[model samples]
Target: MGVGSSSQNSSAMVAIKSQEDQGSAPDLKPKKKICCACPETKKLRDECIVEHGESACEKWIEAHRKCLRAEGFNV
Candidate 1:
């Protein structure tokens, strides 16, 4: 019983470790690419590049809007 319990614990630990080792895991949805232009939207594009990796122009626009809002901008 002790051995069985230890084995089970070990397996669980392995599974947990594997999950952690996988890191955040890529999103199933396709990632978008950023235009890298558009000054009003480039801030978030640059930030996303630094944060969540490269993203699409649309995503950058969205991120820029969020960033601007967070920064107290009226955008």
Candidate 2:
């Protein structure tokens, strides 16, 4: 009886471990983080990057960075 109970527990542990291994992480960071609360700022920054390129879009980028920072996001 003791051996049978131990076998059952081991099987249950294996099943639990398999489920954990197969589960996707919900807290994974995104590939890119757009400003959530500042759509206008994000759009302006995106347009600046498109029209002027990254090197020339410093001010627009900084503005968006500040906005994103204020909203508690790491730009």
lDDT of each: 0.62, 0.77
Clashing residue pairs for model 1: 32-55, 32-56, 33-55, 33-56, 34-55
For 1-75, candidate 1 gives per-residue lDDT tens digits of 776999999999999999888778643331333332245667656766776766445677686766555444545
Which window of 10 residues has the lowest lDDT sum in candidate 1? 28-37
TM-score of each: 0.32, 0.50
Worst 10 residues of 2 by lDDT: 26-35
Judge candidate 2 against the unseen true structure and give its global Cα lDDT, from 0 to 1. 0.77
Clashes of each: 5, 0
